[model samples]
Target: MSDPTPVFDDLRDESDELDRLVAELSPGQWALPTPAPNWTVAHQIAHLAWTDHSALLAVTDADAFRGLVEKALAAAETFVDEGAETGARLPSAELLARWRQGRAELDRALRASRPGARFPWYGPPMSAASMATGRIMETWAHGQDVADTLGVVRAPTDRLKHVVRIGVRARDFAFGAHGLPAPAEEFRVEILGPSGDTWTYGPEDAPQRVTGPALDFCLLVTQRAHRADLAVRAEGPDADRWLDIAQAFAGPPGGGRSPKGDAE
Candidate 1:
């Protein structure tokens, strides 16, 4: 029918999931080491919370927000220069509370926004809906990192389709940004989410098929795990190549190495 509305529904859906996950965890589990090296679960969640706050600033003041990102990146680079693992440690309870507050503030900001309100982000300007969807993808990516670390699992949800769709669209952007040929053919991407939800992207009759568990797809796209580390399969070369460097989220190319079995 009409173009799919990417708005309040996706935003609310993703926001509810994130808040639910954080609220459900045991305090001790919050500090568990996630897939991100030297970053515990708390760190990952804290980053989400912090990003929401940053997004709000961008919505309110574009220049100030850009300055915020630059300043934060500069400090982060300094820490990375000193030691790859360097980070500010936080007390457990406080970190969790901070995450809760930041997310709450973000939700409030989104709910209050007027239609056509624009916000600057890591990529092109975003509307309130786009802002929320981006946050949803971020939560799932990091949630996988957390779930992977604990040996626990997150069931797939239909909402994953949004993340997959975004990732698929970004595939071409990733290639073009790197001075590579834009894939002219379509690909079929199917993720069997933990909840038994299968999301399909690309042209229906395309030659390629990228199929796997939702968690695995998210991990591969996020660069948190090598393709080999997950149960992933690609039927064609272009599909394989796209899977190799899928930067679904915005910002610079992550430049992380692809895993062994994937993109080989």
Candidate 2:
């Protein structure tokens, strides 16, 4: 089995990168609206904090985590926004502090878990590595929203590997979420990473294929950018459809972003 320490280290770096973006923001800046409809910069951080808190509970207290799951199941649609809304209402400093503390606690809990132990999540059980990957994907995606709102262009890093991996792995979940059966045959996916190295998945000779820049694929799976605005291409019918519904994060299909240059 692969060591999960590197992934956990990457998770911390990803979180810190995002922290740098908002650490110095003024209260008014915290109120600045992000690309996610009705979500401000504060809302983005609040959501991450909320999720980290949930993750902490999942790792350290199963019963409490189950309670959270029940709460979410009861209000599948509103619970996410409700959590963000509640946290977003806190004063900026308090919110920032809470987010930092929660994620720190979560990191420690994940590192301290027994080997091979798995924890429940919204979609399925996950090992510590899988949990870290999911958190990094979300951090990057929401960070994109905050960056776009601030007109900042974040430099892409190899940390995107985690996001790309989750995106590729979630292909079947993406289809299933939309009530479609997953294609039986695997589709090849090749993406050019930020460093110009190609990241490839599935059989090379597979009839279906997707090829694109890694950044585009990550943005696509996260639904942070509209498909029309991305460079990802699909060579077969199933692969083509996969791009349309691809989502890295768990939950119902999201109402994706409007195309670039289109009115919101």
Candidate 3:
């Protein structure tokens, strides 16, 4: 079993950075709308808190977690928004406190999980490190929405490796979610990280390839930016198609952001 400590630490750092961004916001600012349709800054944090609570249940109690799964299955489209709505209605201070407490508890539970233990998730069973990586991916992605709403420009960090890993790993899932067949051969992915280090995945000399800055790929998979706005490029039809429909987070494919100026 891979030790989850590093991803756990990165998850903490990612959450804390987002917390700092919102911690001092005025209540009115908390109500400011973000790029996600009908979602405010409060909704972004609320969604994170709701997911952390769900993760806590998954790690601690299988039966309870299944109940959550059932609820999600029943509502399908409305459940996520409902969860965020409930939390978003709370007073800003109370909401923040709840989010902080829930995530901290989740961290402790993940750290205490037995080695090699796998927990059920909305998509598939995940080990501790995978779960932590998912959390980091989400925190960073939703934090991007909050940062955008606040007109803040956050520097890309090496922590994005977690997001990039999930994006790459989810390649097949992305295809399946879109009702497309995944290519038989793995595509090479080469990403330049913020610090000028190269991160590579799959075999070198693969016929299909993707190459880009790590930050752009993360944004692409997270659906925070439209493909047209990103510098990420693809070689070959399968790889090019993957770029169009890529999604890092689970559930149904998202209604991705429109190309810049198209929405305006």
Give me the candidate number with maximum lDDT.
3
- How far does residue 110 in candidate 1 sit from its true spot (Å)? 0.7
lDDT of 2 by residue, 76-191 (tens): 88999999999999999999999999999999998999989999998789999999989999999999999999999999998998999999999999999999999999999999
What TM-score quantifies how close candidate 1 is to the native fold? 0.78
The whole-model lDDT of each prediction reads 0.70, 0.94, 0.96
What ordering of candidates by TM-score runs from best to worst?
3, 2, 1
lDDT of 1 by residue, 121-198 (tens): 766888887787787888778777766667766666777766766777788887876678988877787778667766
Each prediction's TM-score versus the true structure: 0.78, 0.98, 0.98
Clashing pairs in 2: none
Worst 10 residues of 3 by lDDT: 1-10
Please list the residue runs of candidate 3 whose C-alpha ends up more than 4 Å from where it truly belongs after superposition. Answer: none
User: Which 10-residue window in model 2 sums to the lowest lDDT?
Assistant: 255-264
**Please, what are the lDDT tens digits per residue for candidate 3 over residues 1-264?**
556799899999999999999999999999999999999999999999999999999999999999999999999989999999999999999999999999999999998999999999998799989999999999999999999998999999999999999999999999999999989999999999999999999999899999999999999999999999999999999999999999999989999999998967
Query: lDDT (0-100) at residue 254 of candidate 1?
Result: 71
